[model samples]
Target: MILGFGMDVVEIARMARILAGPPARAERFLARVFTPAERAYCDARQDRAGRYAARFAAKEAAVKALGAPAGVRWSELEVIRAEGAPSLTLAGAAAAAGARLGVARVFLTITHDAGVAAAAVILEGAQR
Candidate 1:
């Protein structure tokens, strides 16, 4: 069953500014907001701004879908792609929050275009 749903949009320019800033500041911002894998994946892309924006939106959407639980860190929710399909892998506080909420799995979708990035998330509950 569907436990929760959420969607978010981000401006590509916002992420671009953070990435294009001074090294130390950029690193700090990235480190606080994104996981290592997510940083690697987006940094490897030609359109890093779009990729990062999409991932940012995905993280926000995941948190909203998870009911904005306390102590859920941003880096704990990773946006992963396999064979071009996007999904969420929660760890740390995010995983614990999901467990508490009975979220069996989280479905994710992300898209970017026209200087904007968007993501949608659906939290599925465990079978009773």
Candidate 2:
């Protein structure tokens, strides 16, 4: 059963602007927003900004899926690649919130196209 659903869309150009900033500036934004694994994965891709944007959307979607829990931090919700597909894991306060909300499983999917990036999350569990 599904408990919640959420989706988000980001303009690739927005992330591109951030990535185009000075090295330290861009690093600061990336470091604050993404986990190391996400940074590494996106940095290795040719469409780096698009990849980053997709992850950003994923993070937002995950938070929405949890009903916008206040304890969840940006970095605490990680977007990852498992078996060549997008996956998500909630950690720290995010995990605690998910547990409290009865989130048994998190389903994630992300895509980029025509200068836009988007993501959707489905929270599956015993319905409340």
Candidate 3:
């Protein structure tokens, strides 16, 4: 059963600007919002801004789909690379939200093109 669904889009240029701002400020934002592995993956790519923006959109979509409660930190919704596709892992408050909603599976899709990045999330509830 489907629990919820959500989608989000972000401007790559805007994300680029955010990531390219004052060193200390940008670092703080990145460290606060993204996990260490996520930062490493995006930083190693040529389309760094696009990767970061896609991940950000994915997080936003996941949060929306989960109907997560307040205090759900950005880093708690991590985009993970799998063999076939990318997936999301919830932690802390995010996990609690999924459990509260009985979400058993999550479907995620992300893309970047034409100066924009977008993501969609589908929350599947556990079967009885």
lDDT values of the candidates? 0.92, 0.91, 0.94
Better of 1 and 2 by lDDT: 1
Q: Residues 1-128, candidate 2, lDDT per residue (tens digit)?
A: 88889899999999999899898999889988999999889999999999999999999998888889886779998987868777899999889988887889999999999999999999998755
Please provide, for model 3 over 6-121, each residue's C-alpha lDDT reduced to its tens digit, 9 standing for 90 to 100.
89999999999998899999999999999999999899999999999999999999989987579899999999985989999999999999999999999999999999999999
Query: In model 1, how large is the Cα lDDT of residue 42?
Result: 86
Which 10 consecutive positions of candidate 1 have the poorest summed lDDT?
Answer: 76-85
Candidate 1 per-residue lDDT, tens place, 59-118, comes to 999999988988988889999886878989999998988888898989999999999999
* RMSD, one per candidate, in order: 1.0, 1.4, 0.9
Give residue 61's error in model 2 in angstroms: 0.5
Query: Model 1 off-target regions past 4 Å?
Result: none
| Ordering by lDDT | 3, 1, 2
Name the best candidate (by lDDT): 3
What ranges in model 3 sit over 4 Å off?
none
**Given candidate 3, what's the lDDT at residue 45?**
95
Pairs with backbone N, CA or C atoms under 3 Å apart (clashes), candidate 3: none
